[model samples]
Target: MHEMMKAIATAALLLATAMPALAAPAPVYDERPAKLADATGVRDYERRAVEIPMRDGVKLHTVILIPKGAKGAAMLLTRTPYSADELTGHGSSAHMGIAIDGYDSAPDVVAAGGYIRVIQDVRGKYGSKGGYVMNRPFVGTSLNPTKVDHSTDTWDTIDWLVKNVPESNGRVGILGISYDGFTSLAALVNPHPALKVAVPMNPMVDGWRGDDWFHNGAFREYNLTYIWEQVATHDNASHYELPEADAYTHYMRYGSVGALASAHGLDQIGFWQKIKAHPAYDSFWQEQAMDRILAKAPLKVPTMLVHSLWDQEDIYGVPAVWKAMKPADKDGMLFLTMGPWFHGQEIERADSLGPVHWDSDTGKWWRRNVLAPFLAHYLYDKPMDVATVTAFQSGENRWQKLSGWPEKASSAKLYLHADQSLGFAPSDKEAALDYVSDPANPVSFMPRPNKQVGYEGNPWPTWLTSDQRPVSGRPDVLAFTGPVLDKPVAVGGDPVVHLTASTSGTDSDWVVKLIDVYPDEVPMDQAMGGYELPVTMDIFRGRYRESLSQPKALTPNVPLKYTFALPPVNHVFLPGHRIMVQVQSSWFPLYDRNPQTFVPSIFEAKPADYVKANQKVSVGGTEGSYIDLPLVSAPPAE
Candidate 1:
């Protein structure tokens, strides 16, 4: 990879050379007709419902999809918390449906591409036996408990399928999205010999952090509608009731989210409620997070890691996991494609047909170029199709392959100068910025719809990376504004925050927001060419700064370094756009409020323990504070 940086630099310079024509007429891909619906014998693919037992005694319900009469063929496994039947609705009709035997889940799609497939329920969920725990679980106390977890169960299931199934090529690939995405990753942790390639999409890598429950540390805590409880348990994964859709409203701010929690009891968030019980990075969250004990994966075979840069959820988690692949030169074999869409919204486009425009499609691209060929090579000895790093460019509406992430661009840091400027040095001699975080009044960057509707759920992007101005007027929000740019500046990659000031009390929390300030206040209604919507915005919590493994309490007046990952993005900060970063001390119920007391758990702290603290964003010399951008230049606007 020695030539990587040079190749990237040359490519970036070439792209800059072509920026004049960079903006293309938005490329449109008409929703192509389903090829399998009309293909010969495609619908006749064999599928059977079966239950596979784990070493711990879980008889997980599954569906096996196989080409009629397939023999000794490699298997592709996809496990899901979502019913196997649900995935069929997600992909091309040919790949529709689920299976457990590792053969029937995707027999048609695999058969056309020529491989066997399997889809199964995770441990205790769906038709699978055993109790379920909401979210991926860590082993609980020693009383009677689950026989095995997602990892153990997956290993057991694959071992059995590779031997019992006739055309078993003895090799398997595990896959899924969202919940299944987590399961896909879970399977890879304690892998089976048969598990060859794994594609875990939009995986919930950070357990309770930002993956599913919390949004930038502030959770979307929709108590009534959350499905986690139903899918996670000690015996079975089934439907658990939500707090009630009526419980949430769009206009309710962080204060409201806090109130709702109080009404439900401390830590009303089921998983978080449980998390509060294990405040210090006890074994609980550790077991749920597989990234900590990653498997020895040179991956051995081809694999694709996919996620959306704007994936309202699961944003920061996947990319971090991608980079953690050990010995990239060895079994750490992996490729990544991050685009500008929320979760699986781009998989089939919400409308199912497209000259699609929601950033580049990683799903179809992978299924066609990567998945199809992978199966051929691993199962039938076919040659591989494309380069390693394939990614989607939102502004360009195109796919570009790279030797690595950020594709070759210089690493630069845009620091936070205490003088109110965002460049290298602060215009002020002052040491810090300070804001009080009264859990009763969390400074919000999210929008306010009607008081009765939820401004942040389901059909998101409505509140995503929207804007910092909503909370800009709050006394608690310390906004930092930068001068307008001379040319379009594109920022891509994770963002970090570093500081040198401490809390006045034992502990305090920090909240940061990155915003894209438009040349003019584009009203929400006119955002999408007359569609009312806010600008783009993102936030991050500060307590878990040093280590996600555990939360550390701050020492009074002690300065600390807090580096957290911001969601990835591919937005064009057009010339004249003012870029801004806001720093404060609270994001409220979305993230549990730090008690300012720096106690073991914020949840248990009383009101008197709360205290105010000063924050300092420095620049100059070694205090080297800044936001790093994966500033890779893309191909000229096509």
Candidate 2:
């Protein structure tokens, strides 16, 4: 009986081995939808995707949207590094308004005007075929030896559209926000004959000088994620995963931004390496500064530069470009539009920002009146009158049409006086205020539980408009408060800061903020009472105080003059409101901390380099500090 049972077990095992191991249970199907549902009857606009060949023999992926039954429609083009497919086809709907809604496209302007909308992915990004360079240098420049640049690609794209698109007129207008805005500005360099108008809204004109990459000489460390995600892949498939909920803590975990980037393998990225190699504002940054480039290049096309008052990303760009291009506007081809919005808020809803609210929809009004009319006039040859400068005056909550920007304003000096007082007149005696700047315990740029830099699910866009009370009370921050205004103090154009300061260490960072303090009580919004709103502010690295290209160590403990300009401000200090200025050594995570001890490169600074230093600011007398306000008279009632 035992022999028979053994024989049966052996036979069963043999059969199981010969049965292909149960056939591996057949691979599980993905089950999730592979593609979106077809939009046959629901489709409103005709969509076409094609690869337009560049002069360098690289093809760029482009998506064109022609309104149904359109005839002789003007083409509105937007060249972007962000995907063209994602920008044009965000949603499926019968109405073009719902289908095309994103960062670059304005639904109201496009659908209402019956434009042939076109969006193209720049070379080496998304569907484009070529090597990608961040802010690709001009074709003849040393950085870009290739025959292709954003300008050439734009010229080729416009040339193709004018010849190929059957439902469009020969005239083409280019417009975009942010990076796309930068591309629009690029098109103005040797613009195509068909490209009649260009609008660069909140564009990044310079990366190193008070733009995306750095503010003055201080590195904008928060942009590390942007470089990581953008340059890691051609399609931007990689995303940055935050290690902690609080960005401040996450950044502080590593001694320096360079150390943090190295841990994340960002040293492999070309741009990251370039940033490390070029710590100072050398030829690398100077050659690519669009403001400087366009100043020499011909300005043939009618261009409109849009600036957001509280633009956190590119606050210095539009103003810098506008100032550079102003002298070249011999044909009266340049225009400026300043809005009371955050970065790219003009393309979105701009009725309110943070604690401030406009009674009407400011975005809608600007789009319908200023933007649309300007495009129509140039693209369709429509009879529409637009001003050279359309500025949105904050506090007053009204739009002003001026003959030109900076509007012939008078100058007034707001002196930092003794006893933490700010007045129009200087104090009789010299007074100095002292504060301790500890790099280990740096001041936070915003409130705690801080989110990473992004538009969605983050306070990055509106953080500039947030209340400043949190940092004003810190011991390291010195606040100078002026008396409440009995009458309105109107300010236009830029506010310049002339600071006489000294630091115990060899290297330091100076942060100056011009704030508008609301009244103690408010009838409209109780929450807004006593709110401290930063009107214009900036940071300067002391190492580059004398020369941007050359870094020099400071004469420690000696008072030195540090003069810099805050961003342009068009604000009204209403009756009962106070004007305040806050000075600090660090605006952490927003800008990397300065190692008090001088180092060849702050990026390579060791942990020991970070030391606490005593900082002093001269208030009055021979070596006094003050802010130069561009004072203008109040506009007439509408």
Candidate 3:
């Protein structure tokens, strides 16, 4: 029986193995291809991506957009560290207007004028193949012995565009805001023959002198995240996640910017390290100052310098570049346009900022009447008429056409008097106002619940125009109000601050703000009632008072004269409005904490270096604090 069972099992196993295994169920299949085909025939513009070879053989990623069927159209090129693909591909639409929309596109201008729009990624950024350098030094400079700079790259890009793009008219115009604006200005160093016009809006002329990184020796700590995001990776893939919602709390926790940066792995960033190495305005910064470098050569291109009156980021750039290039504008090639906008608000919605509203869409009007015509004049050879200096006068909300900037104004001194008052006359008796500035609890630059510094989803752009009432009452901030004005007081140029102040500590910082205080009742805008609107304001680090290039410790408790010029202003203090000046020792988070105690480098200051100090501002005597206002003559009848 056992033998019979074994024989049956062996026969069954042999039969199963011999029989063909039942065919496995047909495998489920996905018919879709591994990659989807590129979308075609739905766009109004032909988008082409190309690698333009620079002088050094590095190919820069460039995005070119030509209107369908466009012929002999001029090219508008913008070279930026910001991604060209992101800037040009803002939206996907059949209409060219919708496809090209971003910081520099000016969709309406590009479409109506039928121009080829080109956006190129600067070297070492995005698709560009090279190592990145922050505002790369000019060729032949000690900092950069390399032959390739922004100028050479721009020339190569323009040359490629003119030669390769059959739709282009051979003429090119360049315009951009902020860093793009810097590149626009750089293109003018040794401009390409194809480059006809250039417009640099709110450009960074100098990093260490009131542009981005430092303002008169005070480090702009708020831009540390910008440094990390921009310089940490070739494609800007790195992002800084804020540990705290309130930037004030986030910055205070670290004690110093250097500490905060180190904690976030920013030590690996070369620019941040370079910034730390040169805390003071030294040769490193002086050589990269675009304004100074451009001043050495004659203005080669027809350029228009656009400035935002309340430009939070680049308040000092346009003025500096204008001042430097004005002398070299031998052929009337340089123009200045100052608007009542934020950093880049000229390209965005500009009817209002915060609660302040202009009567009309000022940005649209400027673009149509000023920018478009200026571009057309050179690009399409269209006859155009624009003011040499076009300034939008605030308060009255009117545009002013002038022959030149800072237009022939008389100087008037606005003095700080007793009882927190401001007036044209000096105080008879010597008096002083005191406030304690503690780095531990420093004055917030913007209102509390401060978000990280950025354009979108942040108040950074309009913070300069925000009501100053929130900070006026702070113990660390001293508010001095002037009597109500019976008539209009037009200030048309830069306001100079003459401060006679002393600090209890060996080092300090001084922030002076020129404000316009509204009356108790505003019939038009109730939100603006009693608003302390800052007109022009800036900060100065006390250590650099003697010289920006050198740092010297202040004599404790001794009065020292601190003088610096605020940004240019074109606003009028209308009747019933009062002039105000607020002083403070710290504008924290926006600028790094001064530490109060002197240190070799504020960036490397220890926690113990930060101390509370009594700050005093003289309100009387010949050495009293006052603002030199460049008062203009009566305005033209509207």
Error of 3 at 161 (Å): 1.0
lDDT of 2 by residue, 121-171 (tens): 999999989989898889898998888899999999999999999898889
Tens-place lDDT digits, model 1, residues 304-364:
6777666666765677677667335464367666655566543443221122244434555
- Please write out the lDDT profile of model 3 over residues 150-213, one tens digit for every residue: 9999999999999999988899999999999999999998899999999898998998889999
TM-score of 1: 0.73
Residue 128 lDDT, candidate 1, scale 0-100:
75
lDDT of 2 at 575: 87
- Deviation in Å, model 2, residue 106 alpha carbon: 1.1
Off-target runs (Cα >4 Å) in candidate 3 are 1-28, 454-457, 636-638
TM-score of 2: 0.94
Q: Is candidate 2 or candidate 3 better by TM-score?
A: 3
Q: What are the candidates' C-alpha RMSDs?
A: 21.4, 5.1, 3.7
